[model samples]
Target chain A: MRAAARPGGKVTIAEVAARAGVSKGSVSLAMNDKPGVSAATREKVLKAARELGWLPNQAARSLSSAATQVSNIGLVIARPARMLGLEPFYMEFVSGIESVLVERSYSLLLRLVHDVDEEIGVLDGWGRSKQISGSIMVDFTVDDPRVAPIAALGLPVIAVGHPDLTGGLPSVWTDDGAAVTEAVRYLAALGHRRLARVGGPATLGHSMIRSEAFAKAVADLNLEPGRILPTDFSGEQGARATRALLASAQRPTAILYDNDIMAVAGLSVATEMGVSVPAELSLLAWDDSQLCRLTHPPLSAMSHDVFAFGAEVTRRLMDLIDHGDAEVGAVPTPVLVPRGTTARAH
Target chain B: MRAAARPGGKVTIAEVAARAGVSKGSVSLAMNDKPGVSAATREKVLKAARELGWLPNQAARSLSSAATQVSNIGLVIARPARMLGLEPFYMEFVSGIESVLVERSYSLLLRLVHDVDEEIGVLDGWGRSKQISGSIMVDFTVDDPRVAPIAALGLPVIAVGHPDLTGGLPSVWTDDGAAVTEAVRYLAALGHRRLARVGGPATLGHSMIRSEAFAKAVADLNLEPGRILPTDFSGEQGARATRALLASAQRPTAILYDNDIMAVAGLSVATEMGVSVPAELSLLAWDDSQLCRLTHPPLSAMSHDVFAFGAEVTRRLMDLIDHGDAEVGAVPTPVLVPRGTTARAH
Candidate 1:
């Protein structure tokens, strides 16, 4: 009855029943979704299978497959899950993806990897055998190696990043350059001459765009472009950067962070160092997560409609995967959410 | 070379190639993960699938099966993915489980569900089929019906909840009664005359214990317990409860929340209503997620190490599933984390 060699042999239904604390009949009832078993009991049977580390038998798989199928979509986060959490943009964006995916009875295969190489490997493995029908790619760096890897293989994929990085992949992106210009212009309008930015890793295309835009804004304002402190999007790094920035001789009254978590960390660091927010220093954040709103004085943020962006990207990916001819991609706009963190220069 | 009747056969790869502005060989390279196609061309192939409503045949399933060889554990979150994002407990707990599962070459089949009923189907149907070995169950209630379903089917399951709800199955639980008692005693010791608790949903067994314990403490201390406001653990519910309490003339100086998210909502409500924390009012949070530490001045909490709890639960489940002769359950204890939110009652 067994098709192939597994490291472990098949576990009997009796063992599954024993582990679930139910009878074999209960297991059979749950497996069949018959009226005999209660909802709670069915869950227990399922839980027992999980605990036993059981896989589906051929018969069970065939039975379940006939009714409902699990749709898989590959997602390579391009960062550790912990770091990804710092940017509320991810959660909202994921929520958006889930909003659509759930409706379509699709499931997400999410992975957190350290580098672009690993990300590409994950994609190659997921796509080649059809573990997923399609996949989404993020965090495009200039001259990204993944672009060539994907292009050469002709894998079915969507790039949620810069078009320049993909060498022609269907891309859905936020206008980071435009958003950075707006953030800088706002700082200038506040009569702040010197401004500093705590940014994400330098390898990210969005970071590069923001960094270049920040430089251009500084030159346009004739204000000290000040310094660009690149960070790994870690709260600890943001705290240290804020501490060092404060001790500088050319201290800036205004500071902008790449994401909300960093801004929150910066707030804690600034408060510890006896810097008064908005009075002695002004703070800003990008990717306005709920953390921005929860701060003692809320954080002013350069917010994009991230949830909508996710939905749009998902729609595009689905389209690219399902339709032979579809409109390729779109560049989303951004808006600034004003909270308690920013004010006119003191 | 054709297998069973397949859907995608009618639409030849040539049609996809013709519509995608690429050659058939480029399309083949993209589909096969062979070099020669560009990232853009690959995206064209993927986009075509989405547009054409094509589901790759055995591509994803066969591919993933070859790479993982990892044992699977099904996890039904029993909550929407968005809410799951806000709760730090899941992030930490899942990490804890993964920290151990990875070593065993076990992967978690994580799903976010809207209700308990949907979960039953997931387990009985998808979870029953070789998707996972055993599943983890959480938030047990009195007269939990899952016990019977699992018992009947005889599936191997481990519960990260109470024993009774697990239907005498191996379970891991927190000592919520003792934790609640300690919280009330602490408040009473602080000279507070009135106490109130914003607890989780009534259907959850943990909430029942916490509520009962809170009631007993109030009666023993000769303080008015008033009411246990049970909520769905949403931010809006927390805000509404806080407002109602604040409007009351018998406003208690001390308020305890079932979770960090609700506590955060309470903090916001208090702030929005001009109530100074620990000065005009005091707050306490249970479960001790990271949000407590990140909040302004930090939140005082009844803390238990959830990461450890998750790990312990996983281990216990494995024990039951593997050996079937072991101490099936252990209840963890909670200690108070005295941060800035709680102080001597005014």
Candidate 2:
């Protein structure tokens, strides 16, 4: 099934054997460089493999033979280079991955791409060239194009996304939909009638899940739907979105930001405009970082252990590398942590 | 001189040729994999190279042949993995490096270590195995133990420190001594009789350079040397240092933080303790990030273009990889950008 799902469709050892006019065991023997297969039959099997563009599992290959599989794991992120520096989520995630990697003395091969296509190419090249033993994929979008090419190459990967979006890749994700629902319910319970959400890019799978959950929660509570303004997860964009929302005639009493950096920026916008926080505007940040505590009036956040999440993803990847299969599931639900920023609606 | 300074010291192609009982040109041809070398001569030359632990210039080898040179560059940091998550310096620096690396479509191999010894082992393994084309080295301590092993391996490297501290490796650095002098002069000019600095760890080369410069500046200005507290550059440590300073019977009228996170934490400390910025106390932060701007009364800082510095370091490394040599020099001086945090001493 997985071979069929690859870029050019599923290619199996049986298919290779049939095309080569040899038995499956003979084909395997030829492919594995073992004896009992004639040179001509071996050549036919090799030709069929080349023609079919079949990729054997490098991890499995390394286990059977003395092939020099690089003790490096590739991580390709499609993000603006400037934003990557300031975002606490990525830094924390990378640190978490390193915690596990250091135990095995493995290195991380990090690459930043402008889009998903680039990420796929980079991963495919790494797989074909044997540059890494495994890879961890993050920031999945709807129907991510990276899935097929990666699966086709049979590269061991641990995807950071919901199962629906990962296309059968072993995935680790926080329950974003559940977290969004919780955030909205908490704000509603605080007697806030109108709520707004500052979301990340519309293209991201997690952002889409959060947005849909927000809509559902609003309808379920019979409250006015919060305006969800998509942003690139930069502080400047966060501030701009906050300014626009506040300037509107029917402004929300509370705002939920997708990340802490943007939430901090939104807070700054409120202060700049002389809007009293919690008294008039309640701000909540996601992926609670130390930035929440450092602000003038500390921010309330949707708190989860991102470091632990990263470690969990890395653990799954290591398992995939060693045992050749892993369970895909959500790690944990983010809890609403109350702080100075969020209070009873006045 | 660099050859003599290597670990086993003074290994040369001529010495290798004499040991192999071949001419120097034959040794060169064999090492470079050129057509002029015979099979037996090439074997002897390679054996001699192994016996002497000499590695030919990898960049040259890549240029001449279709060797599977990994399209990756190695970066190893000797720091606690937890701290790396919160530190903006490395993220920004890494972003800058990405700005250049992206253009060439190369991957960055990142690793974190507990100390210099671990860092040395990692780099040695990478060099010996050709896991990377080159590497970037940072955080040089006084008499850094990493230099000799790295140099002996003849791996192309770009050291991120002053030349005096980098042991003959091509380096890219900011003038920390000058930046310290400027910060001190700025504070003294504001009529602050007592000045203190929250510096990074004492073992770091840059920290020592800044400390000595601070002492000289204090003496030249006819003022007593203010206390310098060393920290691990964490916000919590910064807050603790600030609390201790403010609680002292002879508190400093002004304080300088080594980084923006620490300065922001110190600002929070001042507010919580009923101290006023630029009124009863003056605060200055280093490495001005967007965090400096987001605070209530924006922080004044010694600002430098860290992204450009990272880019410059990468450029020099690319040069080193391409040409087998590069020039070492300071990138730029950090300028004092005054904001609300600094004011005249009352």
Candidate 3:
């Protein structure tokens, strides 16, 4: 056995093993409470470790071959923190991610960045520092700059966006285009010709996809050209878009929103403007949170289980980390749930 | 100089220093970009580190005397993840905490546990592993079991609850008691004799504080005995409590909710039951989230800036970490923000 060498007077595991009259490997198994160690040996190791005042330094353990013992998964969200707080999608998604992570005794290292560039920097730092085992990337845009650099880092990652936008990265995504088409078809079936969509920033990959799908759906139904107004996904902006659509020369009979908060805001705006819901205007919301049910004329929504989506994404990432690769797939498309906010157009 | 020793074939700073023909301290200074190293020395160290493919391991650095280099702050929320996502207060508070942390280039290590016992375990692990420099504890209940164990861990923590509940930990809290009293007085001034309060779980420290204050305020104002119902802070429970209150033998002329979600839920229940808000029933909400403004007859609220409050708690934690102590103080109390949902009872 090696003699105790207290570097900077801090107790080392080797010293504990030396004191316990066991090999370093036995000490590790005993400390971690893994199998292959007898109860007597484990007790002796624990007593020696206690007497030596040795706390298992996870940092040192990470440096050795036991890197798998470090259980931290990174999630970098590229959005304004203020806006992120109000959006139910992320919170629910994180909760879903947490549900899966807790089962494995892994922790999620969450960071909110201003943009993709900042997110890349954060991810790169985490990768080099070995602070995270894997990462989940969100909010992909057209020709996302993060794809190339992040891929080069060779860190296990799961991108949460369209396959085209993710640049061949392993990804789990929702078919927003299909969901949008379904929503338009449902509204058209209800005898709506003049349709409008209040979308998120046009630069967002999913938003652009939804916009294109909306236009195609309108054309296919032989309806007038659909109006698409983009916003920053804020309630105030959603209210403004609703007002503009209502006050237009040829006011649309139906409006679709990118999220429930904006949909709720549009509902309030309709009430304030004395425009009756489902009578003068039919409103459809995306990402049906509890907010949809809490509204007066509970909103119709293109609803998908976001919590399940989050769980699926996490499961894929975990698979990638454990088995070195995971299959790329699409989650369930959002389906139209016709609530009080939609009715036959007059 | 000592020859290169690759125990696990991982390049160390000592190897880099030997290759650079400089001291290990100079190599560290150059790598961290700290002052005291000359420009030429810095360049030499960088070149050697690059040639050796040496990436500074943060975990190893944390184990060394430079433990301050690790910049993680722990935040554990002891609530069900499902409920946490729907509550805007926590997300906004986290965002606020992040805002302050970003300025200092620190990161928040967030976790959601089942209860206080789980939270204590998580905190203890974090403390022992040196994964976090400090932590922020929230959701204190009566006779919080966490105080003594957590205090014993000797990790710097800022408790977000009343002093009595925090059990001598440095704390930052809002005056919920004073706010409840003021809310009762405001309703009484509006000629509301029959008032009702839908509170959070009675076991919660703040909830108990508010309950006692409500009773005292009712007695002091010579008003009718008020009805207080407690829920799990869910919108569904809020709706159920509202229905129960409205169905009572002496229906309240005014109702106050513990959160904006519950208040919004209560509003929907009132509308469903054919009760005219402010005409036959008045509603007041706590924690003025955007949901309060989105509702029809925008909810009147006991409003306080939760975002700012979160920022303040982080600042205090930072101070405690830097200065070894922080002052216990109450933030601005929630003030009445009367909007369309409140009026003089007939």
Candidate 4:
């Protein structure tokens, strides 16, 4: 095919490389915005390509891939966040993914699924129908049925969850287990012995990991088991859990909320019930959402860059899917966002 | 094509209507889940189809019409909201859109773009290329260069912003004019003669409408000028604006933020600056994000169901693209959410 007379025409990778005085492979790398090619070299290549009017043969490349790929990534999330909207983390992660995708002229196909089974079926069917290049897996549960079913299709898969639960596929997860321990240690340093926790759904793999860590940390300190309450990670459940904890005869002085939504809900319930934060009782949160800073007394949280985490996963997935089993592992470290929610335990 | 042998081989619309003792058109209405097929006839047709194990041939219909339509709705969004993660509004709106899409055997293609020009190019190209059957448009600006350009391509479009700005395409929007007036009236009722607002981007079609209403309402109440500060609808900008306003000697008693992120950011800044909310200052936000409830003292906001708004737009877009010309009109009106941030300016 010949280049069009219009502003942007087909500038081949060879022409780009020739203009930049580099190899075709180098031009390909620079055009795809991959690292190792210096920022200056990448810019020069892109500028040259634009001047030459180049568009990557994205559709053809996808069609000719070794695995009979579909040229796009499919992400099926469990339920829509609704009032929660796509959080900053999700946005940043998506931007990170798109940063790479747009360069390759690839698309990300996102969907909201009502159930795990439905998602499993969708993944299977889309793969079978050649509608996706690869899939992004999230919200894994113990003995995850989705993994087994998807694995059966021999589709290139990358999971965004703990590896232990993901059947050895390339996986990415935040260090929830270590993060829970850090939360306990942070509270302990503030002179709190008695503690309570409002956890997310016990079925989720990350939730279970964190719950176990909380127990082990408490057990090491010889604390009571009745203080831990597991509920679906939602604001309503958080409010209910807070009320029940506050009503208990052995009410703990410090409370840990699994996510920001629940922490905010706990904050409300505490206010309504007349239990002051970091005064009469101390509180903390996991998954530091912007909600933490919005409350009267801001919440201290176990913070991990969810956006970066998601971005990192997308990057690794692209690598593995493209290069066939690239090394994939992310450092699971948790940073403490010490806000006003926790104090020297009353 | 051979049937997969799931139940009764290919129980066509003819068979469904025959079983239900209705015409093929009635069966079409019933199977497509559209209104006006009568509840009795619809139920009977569905039951008969279920027993016979049939699925709709959307592809066949499209091919017959010379419409190589992909089974997905293209959702293109502009600016800061897209940068912010999945807010509950989009999550819920997308959820609502998806429910319809899935039931109709369609998928949703969500995209984020930088500006109107990029969008115009995308829509024009996609429509011309016949890659996407139709698109959902949002954030209408006055003299929107995008309007005539996309229309010329004859691509089906549905706007989800101000009706007047939509160029007669079917539109879905919350009544910003009414909502703004009510917000101003509420603040005036609370003895707030001096009120300032941090609104969305200047180029946005709805922002212009809201700003106009704000000015009108403020003047009607005989208030001062230079109180409306239009922002890019970002958390950082909102915080910065809040700081500048609060630092001034003539700062307003109550302030309104365009969206929940800005409200939350402003609230945080106030707390950091030792400002007492509802005591020293009152704050309100538009778009009723969950950030309101998550805050210490929840925010009071101009509330409306954005999810329903999105779904409504999606449905209209699908109809326009698949069925023909646009169905231009008004949608729902916005309401107020009374939360903890707004109080009497004593």
Task: Give the top-scoring candidate (TM-score).
Answer: 3
Show where candidate 4 strays beyond 4 Å.
Answer: A1-71, A80-96, A99-104, B1-69, B80-82, B86-89, B124-131, B325-327
Off by over 4 Å in 1: A1-69, A84-87, A114-117, A151-155, A324-327, B1-71, B101-107, B151-155, B314-327
Q: Report residue A8 deviation for candidate 2 (angstroms).
A: 52
Q: Please report, in order, the local distance difference test score of every candidate based on alpha carbons.
A: 0.72, 0.82, 0.83, 0.69
**Every model's TM-score:** 0.78, 0.81, 0.84, 0.77
Error of 1 at B238 (Å): 2.3
Q: Each model's DockQ?
A: 0.10, 0.14, 0.18, 0.14
Question: What is each model's TM-score for chain A?
Answer: 0.80, 0.80, 0.83, 0.75
lDDT of 2 by residue, A203-258 (tens): 89999999999999999998897799999998889999999999999988999999
What level of docking quality does candidate 3 show? incorrect
Model 2 residue runs over 4 Å out of place are A1-69, B1-67
lDDT of 1 by residue, B144-216 (tens): 7555445434456776776656656556677788889999999889888788899888888889988988998
lDDT of 3: 0.83
Count residue pairs with overlapping backbones in model 4.
19
lDDT of 2 at B133: 79
Pick by lDDT: 1 or 2, better one: 2
The sequence of per-residue lDDT tens digits that candidate 1 reaches over residues A40-144 is 897788777655645336454565553444456767765654444345567677767777776665666666555565566566566553446677788888977
> Clashes in model 3: which pairs?
none
* Per-residue lDDT of model 3, residues B1-346, tens digit only: 1111122237888999999999999998876656999978977886676555464764554344332355779998877768877888887898888778777767788777766655665775666566778999999988787776566556789899998898767788999999999999999999999999999999999999999999999999999999999999989999999999999899999999999999999999999999999899999999998888899999999998888898899998998888777766899999999999999999
Error of 3 at B252 (Å): 1.1
Better of 1 and 4 by TM-score: 1
Q: Write the per-residue lDDT of candidate 2 for residues B151-225, one digit (tens) a residue.
A: 655668888998778876667889999999999999999999899999999989999999999989988998767
